[model samples]
Target: MTDAELPEDLARLWRRPTGSGSRLGRPAGLDVERVVRTAVAMADAHGLAGVTLPKIGETLGVTGMSLYRYVGSKDELLILMGDSAFAVEYIDAGAAGSWNEGLQRWARGLWRAYQEHRWLADLPTSSPPRGPNAMAWMDAGLRAMRPLPLDRMTKVGILTLVSGYVNTSARMAQQLEQGWRQSGGVDPALAAQRYGREMARLVTPDRYPDAAELFSSGTFDTAAAPATATPVDPAEANFIFGLEVLIRGIEATTASAALDTH
Candidate 1:
């Protein structure tokens, strides 16, 4: 779509009254928020691909064409739904003690939301967030970093990195969980063991010494999993590790910047 379409879509999502004569005399049975909420429910129940205008209209007891009165298009509907789905009070930076603590809380909250709404990771982000809730979440993230010695753009970039990691981690976890479910509820630990044995039988140490050594190191052994694993969810330990590493990088960068200014 052209850049010209973005403003119109944002207007539709924010429910700003279009002064156009086409929308001046609209009926009141449906509203933008309700339409967006319904669309979100549809997406949550199914996946993003399953959320079509016709399906949303059917669920709302209206014809597909009627939904256009509230939402400009399916693209507009998706923007609204994504904003609404993330419309939650996940953290309070003011009471979070320190910037690091607040940011950790923020990241964890976002991770939980992505887990609960698995389809959110599938939503197209070609456009920047314009809806109220989306902007609010962004504001919260910035607020969490208020005590940091970073520039505004740097802080925003930090949030982007944190959110990107959360989305990727959540998507991977979702795929793994779905695969496990598809395999008739096989325990992940058992699956790992079976895959390791198969790899051992297939891979030869002569040509692929690294692979063979990794396979022999018992790193894949879930039976000997660490007790102090981060995130408490074995499937999400990597996410925790990556989050901590990213936070440390940010701290180092900001600290260097501070020292340079002195």
Candidate 2:
């Protein structure tokens, strides 16, 4: 579509080459893609705060204002980075053996996307998907649920739930990891033990019975576990566990509908 046909953000986001190639008199070897690529690299290394137009321009050996030729502003560059970060190879949802399996793969893909680009969790949410890659991911999610007996709206709702869950879980995980690093990089097992001990000390059974019981259960004693204990990463283990529970809940809720349709 022509730039005129799309909103200002999308027009810049979905800009295409005009066969004529680089604009006349513009510097050779510099273009929108290069500018965006450089910006994404900066964000990946130093985060969104470090990705000013001036920094991008300096990285590309040009003046800060020169970047205006490619991106309208830092906001526009963020939109581009948000889209480019999802450039991971798309997994066709149709290839799955079952709807749940397809959705599981889709959700895991999103989690991996968050893991790879932690800054995505920090970006402002764009509802209705504002870019091509974002729209493609949404389409993949819908395709994954094609086998569901639910109506389109229900399917959309499910997709939204799954997407929201992945984003929330991934964001929390990133924050926790960041906190862990900031606190002198203590071992996770030791951290868990310390947390458990502190909770046990601070929590009174009469005041908070349920949480007190949990703290008393020795569940958080990771350091005392055997050497052969499961080596799985706790963050990944929790994510997978929560995802499975969510999928099971979805399956149970839709089972009756599937039966009725048959």
Candidate 3:
């Protein structure tokens, strides 16, 4: 469809091909892709809040108002940034041996994208993603679930759940790492154990029985003092643990669906 047919916000997203088109009388080197890339870089180095049109223009050696010819406003630029951040080439989800393997690969691919662009987790989901790259991500997830007996909505639901899990998990990890760096960059295991130890003092069984039990179980202590140095990084280990749990849930749902059809 042409840009004219879509809503204003969505039209802006699908309007110009990346780096291919420029407005008349625009600067020699500046284009949509370059501007978005510059903003993405700013977010990567500083943060999402650090990316302003004026800052990007200054980096590109132009006036901020001149950028209006390309992107309409800051909100529109954010939409571009959200789409641009996920510009990684996704693995073909249907190629895997099973839906389980296919989805794991898809989820990991998305996770890697988030890791590369930490600011991505901070971008608010103003509306359903309509950009080419964003739609491609959803398409990949649906492809992975194509073998399942479930219907379209079920597949979409699974994708939404997995996507939310990866985004929130990445955000938490990023926040924790930043906090750790700010607080002397202690070992993560040590950090976990210290938090547990401190919580143990304030939390009581009367008010928080489950939490008290968990704190008293010495789980954090074991993590802090593993028997041998393991090759797996703790952050990745936690990620895989949660990912496998979601995969198992999806597999169970598929199994149920198959049984129902029999």
lDDT of 1 by residue, 90-111 (tens): 5444578878878888898888
Q: Each model's C-alpha lDDT? A: 0.79, 0.81, 0.83
TM-score of each: 0.88, 0.88, 0.89
Error of 1 at 86 (Å): 0.6
lDDT of 3: 0.83
Q: Model 3 off-target regions past 4 Å?
A: 1-3, 15-24, 90-94, 226-231
Q: Write the per-residue lDDT of candidate 3 for residues 138-161, one digit (tens) a residue.
A: 888888778888889888889889
Please list the residue runs of candidate 2 whose C-alpha ends up more than 4 Å from where it truly belongs after superposition.
Answer: 1-3, 17-25, 90-94, 222-230, 258-262
56: Cα error in model 2, Å: 0.2
Q: Which tens-of-lDDT digit does each residue in 1-262 have in candidate 2?
A: 6655566556667765433324665778988788888988888899888889888878888889977777777777888888988864744444888889999999898888887888888887755677778888888888888888678989888988998898889888888999999999998888888899899998989999999998888778954454675687677778999999999999998997778778
Considering summed lDDT, which 10 consecutive residues are worst modelled in model 2? 16-25
lDDT of 2: 0.81
> How many steric clashes does model 1 contain?
0
